[model samples]
Target chain A: MIPLLKRVAVILAAASFAGALVVAMLDLPAPTVHLPAAVEANMAASGVAHPVTAVLLNFRGYDTLLEVGVLLLALLGVLAVTGVRAAPRAVAPAEPAKRMLARLLAPLMMLVAVYLLWAGAIQPGGAFQAGAVLAAAAVLLHLTGILPGWGAPGPRLRVSLAAGFLIFLAVAGALLARGALLAYPPAQAGMLILLIEAGLMVSLGLILAGLFLLLSRDSGDEA
Target chain B: MSASLAFDLLLAAALLWSAWRALATPDIFRAVVLFIVFGLLLTLAWARLAAPDIALAEAAIGAGLTGALLLDAVGALGSRKDGAP
Candidate 1:
């Protein structure tokens, strides 16, 4: 059943590609520009002690803003595909052990999410990771039948989902009025970044959770 | 020759092998599981490269959240197939 010629062709192509990559790596040239040094030089003004955080939330806030928007759009796309009219259905109860474990772990995961959000200002954690952990908690709850798959998100839920992007946009608008986009005043940089991160953490959590929750309703209906 | 270098080489090999298996596996569930393993290995690689932020994100979002989503998709697909004629 095998196609020997095609397989041989594939092997040859792969070997050549690998050989090229190895040669390229071996003969790499030194960098012309040192971005890390530039980032380090400006770290004091970037508002966050953590260089990565500063780059993500301050130096390149526009990208993060767009990323948040993209995520929200993705959730909206999921909602559109799933159709907003599907009614929330009750899921059968999971095993008692799973239920209890979900109850125990959900709160702990929330605490970790918050800790990651807080630590992002000075360490290797941020809104994206924090929001992911929060979403995981919600997923765990749903899997255990503690939380039902979401139907059409209510007005309140919708607002929560958009809150992060809205907040980021508002900040950018205000900063633009003052001078430039997301250019936090040196004195207020820390507070502004924190505020943005807080908003993002909440909205990202909701949006990420919504992706799973919305699509999952179909399985519940089919079941 | 050093211990850390050896560990890094082993990790790299494991990453490549898992990635290959994830792609080549016939079983959808096994492939997804292998993909998750690949993600975790990638997180280790990120950590070894001194990027803990990336490692944490990879572990949580890449491995944890994506794995859950894929597993859910597989379950949904399997159930749909069973219900169909």
Candidate 2:
């Protein structure tokens, strides 16, 4: 009798969720919202043709900066909890096909990542997307034993991991000294955004790859 | 309904089905796999809503990275339970 009651409760919960979903689907307004003119004007001033990039890097720059810090914080939490060190080097998989795929795909992914970063100024790509792609490439390399395990990240890796957050903070600090916080000189806005984005892309890639490696069950044990 | 609407309906149904299975499955690994499928379906739904940027993020970070993390966690838990060397 209790089992039957439990099943009925589950069914009731599912039905409630389904009903809510239908209501939400029916109530959603048509996706024809207009972009505010002020946003367009600001986008022009921000110097990136891609509105999303401009907004993320300029209008809401602080949010993005804080987000990178949040990513770092997550890694720190994982480290404290797991206490698993990283291996100094990676072992290549025995399968020739896996190695071949890594060799062929790594360069291609790197190219695509860079392209995404560059195109973000004019298209749907941006620092976050480019960083994720770069991380994917790094994961591919690590998986196939092209790169060392993150268990023993060197000085270079440490610098790279902090590059994005540091660069962002520096920019914000410089702007604050000049006049307003995060307000770049109109003429140099484009260059500054690009510079920050480049640093962010590298750091984001490293941080993400580091997180994955750190969380893997045998990172330190394999070495 | 038009063909596109039919497609959208099918996609939404698929999303619900996969989500339900993921929640109800007895096997943890199967649930994770189904969750990944649900994330993929969400990516499609984002694209259908004309949010390509969000769709890209959902596909890469949401489905790809999260799925990888979850699978690793499952493996770790299984190993601990089995006392594998």
lDDT tens digits, residue span A77-113, model 1? 9988889865687567799998999999999999999
Worst 10 residues of 1 chain A by lDDT: A214-223
CAPRI grade, predicted model 2: acceptable
lDDT of 2 by residue, B1-85 (tens): 5999999999999998999999989888999999999999999999999877778778878888788878867776765444355
Q: How does each model score on TM-score?
A: 0.93, 0.85
Q: Give a tens-digit lDDT track for model 1, residues B1-85.
A: 5999999999999999999999999888999999999999999999999999999999988998889889878888876555366
Model 1: lDDT equals: 0.91
lDDT of each: 0.91, 0.82
Model 1 chain B scores worst on lDDT over the 10 consecutive residues at B76-85
Best by lDDT: 1
